[model samples]
Target: MPGMPKPIRLLSSQLVDQIAAGEVVERPASVAKELIENSLDAGARRIEIDLEQGGVKLLRIRDDGHGIPVEELALALARHATSKIGGLADLEAVASLGFRGEALPSIASVSRLTLTSRAAGAERAWQVRVDGEGRVGEPQPAAHPTGTTVEVRDLFFNVPARRKFLRTEKTELGHLEQVVQRMALVRPDVALRLTHAGRGLLDLPAAADPPGIERRLEALLGAAFLEHALRLDAAAVGLRLHGWLVRPAFSRSQADRQFFFVNGRAVRDRLVTHAVRQAFQDVLHQARHPAYLLYLELPAGLVDVNVHPAKHEVRFREGRQVHDFIFRTLQRRLAEGGLAGTEAEPGAPSPTIDQRPLVGGAPPPAGTPRQAAMPLRLGDERAGYRFSFAAQRPPAARADAAPPPVAEESTAEGGALPPLGLAIGQLSGIYVLAQAEDGLVIVDMHAAHERIGYERLKAAWAAGRVTSQPLLVPVVVAVSAAEVALVETHQALLQGLGLAVDPLGRDRVAVRAIPALLQGADAERLLRDLLADLAVHGDAGRIAAEIDRVLATLACHRAVRAHHRLGLEEMNALLRDMERTARADQCNHGRPTWVRLTQQDLDRLFSRGR
Candidate 1:
């Protein structure tokens, strides 16, 4: 054969596997992933991982599962070869967590790799060594329990360029922990252990039941999740989805805990995330993401898993159908109160929808404040939104609360510093439409109440003059020891807010009295949520936020019920209160309490005189 070009010759199978390693094994965390998957596929019930310097010098995975035979060690290091599947047809219904089969060879090509395995009945264990360049040392006999231990040392030694891109050791280890967590979440039945430099990092026992599984998740994520979550199950188009999603009232700054699994494989698909947010539209604020764990069970033939080398992303045969299902199901679930929706009991008052005020309304009522014509933007990218003259008012230039605190507080100084205008009427029995100096103001009765309650609680607590009412029945709150610690730390703070809770046991607390504001409220449910927040944030400052949150809910419950035909006098008083209230122009949560525009807006819209 004619001599090939040097560059072309160098790009052989050996180099190809090395190149694949770039994507599959980006850092020590990547190596940890490949090794852990091997352990899981072996049917190991208990898996332990130990790392050092982000596994740059040492990465070890020990699992109790069927080990490799001594003779097959060399073939295991060959590129593109794996015991995971036999041929192309096997790819259709892949049940094993680890596929692709290139993980071992890729690592072996770029790092010093060692594998030790012992069959269940074998008396002696065997070890295999593969150095960079895919060279293998002899398989030597050794002693070990039935299982396998795979170690990769000097990761990226053969690829200096890749090593340079690696992050700090702490960062690399954090990634490793993330992989371990994702795996642990899906496989709750498996006992998972992780250590760094001989120090125990995480040790989670196997979960024997669903509750146990959820408890494990709570521990890993946060105990607050236990209460914030609601179970959702939906089946459509031969696809079944079952999981837990956070209530609209409960959210995080980021969407890190959103887990989606197809069949048994964890994957990230944009359609699902988008559908979730769409379902939660208008419920969550723009930057706040909810937490969810969703599992999808459908025919394997419908999905194409060969789209990416890492297999984290997948293509659906019926992508739109899946998207629609996710959207509708989540929307339905959220509508059921997990998000935001109104409900009334039989014989209870039904909400009266106000059409005129919500859409194009008569020009500003005569004798109203002089408002600037401020334009309002609405609508979304998918479903175009429109804004008509709905109660346009003058624009009073002002902002709501200073940049919100990372955590909520019952009392935000100067929160109610200024009033916007007068409350006119409610829209659809939910939004309180009020009039301001420059524009119309809308307030979420619930959010406004919450802000008022928060401020009240903070003042009382700061003054050490909290008013508590003894519950007709004392309440018992079940929480974890960690939460108990949080409560003890904030005992004085909570007491000052008129809540008296004493730790009765390791994972339980006794509630003696609650804040007078919550006299008729669901004390049990409220305390449970409080403990959940404490467990999640682990910060005393979060208590202040919780107080505000509770107050908001209370306000929603206490505020003039939607559908209540307001007397003109009451409406005028509401408007006057809003005008004198700080943040009157906006709701407590930053949503505009009202929006206004002048006659000029109509002129501009009609282009009568530019």
Candidate 2:
């Protein structure tokens, strides 16, 4: 039996196509992404997408780009055939959105497909038909304008198992719509139209200028994002990043609004994601996601686009440099914006310590300068719904230190002032009530101080280097074969994070050391998470970011908490710092720390305007 030979056979063309289809056509939206990418690559200025039964029954994409010629119509359905790339040099850069020729054949293998195209200046249009069995029909003259239309019907008609995996119409439609949204976001200059079940779902007009682009954004991401968004544009080290991110005040509970593109291609790169997270970590409220639409562009030779069949993922040759660039740029933008509800930017340095008995990070537990926080009730009868001030007294700080840095903005003369105005007095033990030129300013004392402390921790961590500790007993962990391979290759990455990992078994690794700071942390879980992050980032600098979060925890514990009484000067000092500090509008958890009500706003509240 050992000597018996098994005959090797080539798979049928249909089966080969079906196998490739499995990778390219995972769902209805997968088909949509490929076809739409093809349209975009064709230089389509106007594209129409129509779906029926969530694109399971039908998917018709029409584009006004340069249409395919009649001669290439049949070749378009052939496997491994594409006009995008002609040689090795062309494949290296791959500027077009669609290059690999698997989309048409893969889609045709699982569904009924018809491609009709009329090239520019052609007298008549031509069409080619392909069956689910990969059979190609002869081209025929068709009535059409100078454009192309790809109509896919009854997806997975020959594969019941794949069809069975299809979800409800609404769910599938949601996925399809997301693909369209990503496309729409990047190509603001292209007019897009989407129809579902015979009714128009989305119609985006082409916008060529900044204001027009903003109008398009408002139509898609909602007015709140537009109102709060801070525009960011910068370039460095052969890379350019520009886009808009809503302030932390407008962040959503889920990462629904985040969109990042590289070279006009939408990607879910972990390096970019980690950079954004790091930039906004201190100011972003925990468990909330930022809202943004950003673009990063670099030379094509520096990145590989052929790593994945669908091209959703890309590999960067200079992952570390790219990661740092994005992190630093976004962090600076968020800081300068001063109110990063969701717009990304790094934060000022602040010490985040571990204060378990109180908050996450604060000063020394018992013997530090104590500033009792104050709060104002929303609807209290006494003091006209405001907390009564009891002889203002500043919080006690170390006698050795100078009072919080101050640049005077207000005096007894009562003149117009800055946005935060001048600190007037304390309210309750949780809020700082200040008088602005227009009306009143309500400050969440705990929130504001927490942001201040968190920024300081970030600064401290960024300025210093990570110190890793060697483990007395190396911890071995189970892993996939790929992970083992990854561990072997990215040993330097681990070393940088102060971790020493060596492959143990075929699918396991031994952790001989860890970041000195991450000691007593779940070595197994942390390693796995780090491995996962590495898998996504491909060594996009995770150690510094992980340490920053550790600092965030420290800052949370050390920041001032609610119920601590603060004096008039302490309140004013906090206000001044906030005005100067980056991302002062939100706390570490990404919630707004203060709000301003102008005199007009106050008058409207009481009907005084009438």
Candidate 3:
């Protein structure tokens, strides 16, 4: 018995592929993601999916896009074979969403996979079938349209371990629905039809604009989300962030609603999650999470696609900038009149510009206090839709000794005003006015200063210039095996931030100095935070970033806040420095530094011709 041939021989290449499929194909949702991506890559404008019993039974996907040629049918089932990547260099800048050539083989290994494709120029179609044993059958002639049709059935029949782990039918179907919803958001131009157990579940046609996309989302996710959603669009910085952020009132108890994508690929990234939470820190309760569908676009090379096995996490070359941009852009948009709803009121007619005077006459002098002469009243009857003051044009300029550092403009009176900058002018004791070259600016003295201080601290850390104060008493931190590895790799960078540490034992470190910015902090909490960051970001580059992020937060707490009064020179100096900084239009965390209102913008508010 001892000399008998070993029963546990090395797994054959085919078996190894099937084993790898265990990680990639968890359930019906996994197959859906890969198959739908194939349809999208084929340039399909219309896609229809039919599934039965959460795809445990028959699953069929039909598309009307340019399909594969007859000759390529057999090669399509081969392992590690794909048109997405060519040579080794393709791995470095993976552009397509489905680059790993494992999807087809993995799916085929678990289910009885059948592929039927017909290229546009070809006269005939071809079909290929792969049984559960990685055996390829002979290709046969088939009758089909000029597109591909993939059918998968009896998933996990060969792999009992996988099939046993599947959840209830309803739960699995819910997960599948989530996959479809995300894909629809990514490709709004494609018409997607989904059917479950012969019952139609979702039918989304191509949308004309972002609003149409939102409407489709409302139909799928719920109309309540749309009521609380805000749209964000910023085209500069070689990136675009367009999606909806739920209002504070509609915050969810769970974070499952926070969806983010890069170049149409959905990802669950901690950097993005942390940034969003930071933006909503003040508004939402600790247990609540803001729901958002943020789409980011940039050159593929700028992002690293090899971060996760599931392809749900990406590393950007400038992740800090991207994170900052998204957080700030959304927060600013939310702050400025709540993103001006595009959906009109149920019955009210749009106002015609026949009586109301046009705004934007002349720039008001800096320091000249002003308010809206006539605020546009909404339809709420209790507020009484009536003008509060006699509208008049503001004079262009006025002479004063020091030139008012703050400025305000009334659009109802035909005055152009820029968005309020960080700098403040003392008005009525609390109100701060901001001055621009062409218009007036107004701001909340307290909130603006707090945000400014927070940004200054963030900038210092990003530049690797955080000042560390030496600790008179050293603290010791004890951790586990993985945490010790993290501490050792990040020792140098941590020291640079004023944390003096030394290995105490196999799984412990003695902290000699702490970040001066975080003086008198809880040593235990700091150590725990360091370990947590290391666990999530398990690479050299991410570790360094984590160190800087920790230092930035500490410095922010020590910086100045807005409510603190400042002299004339101080306000002027702050504005001057802000303008000179790189990305001065936005803060370190990606929020805008200011918003401007021009004369014509005011005229549009009133029923006036400019």
| Candidate No. with top lDDT | 2
**What are the per-residue Cα lDDT tens digits for candidate 2 across 350-421?**
111111111221222332211111121112122211222344333565432323323344433334354465
Residue 273 lDDT in candidate 2: 83
lDDT of 2 at 290: 81
Model 1: per-residue Cα lDDT over 1-610, one tens digit each: 9887666345677788888887688788778777787888889999999888888988989999988877787777777777777876778766676778788888888889898899877778999898787678999998879999988898888888888998899998988898888888878889999999999999999997665776687678765554445566778889987777665554567778788888877898876676676666545666777778888888877887777787788888887788778878876654443112133233322211111121121223332322221221111121221212223233341222111112222111333211233444456555565544334545555454443443444445566665788887788888888878877888986787678889988998888898775567676676766666455433233344445556556554665654554433445445434433322332334343443433444455557674
Instruction: Write down the TM-score of every candidate.
Output: 0.58, 0.77, 0.63
C-alpha local distance difference test of each model: 0.65, 0.76, 0.65
lDDT value for candidate 1?
Answer: 0.65
Worst 10 residues of 1 by lDDT: 352-361
* Best model per TM-score: 2
**How far does residue 93 in candidate 3 sit from its true spot (Å)?**
1.7
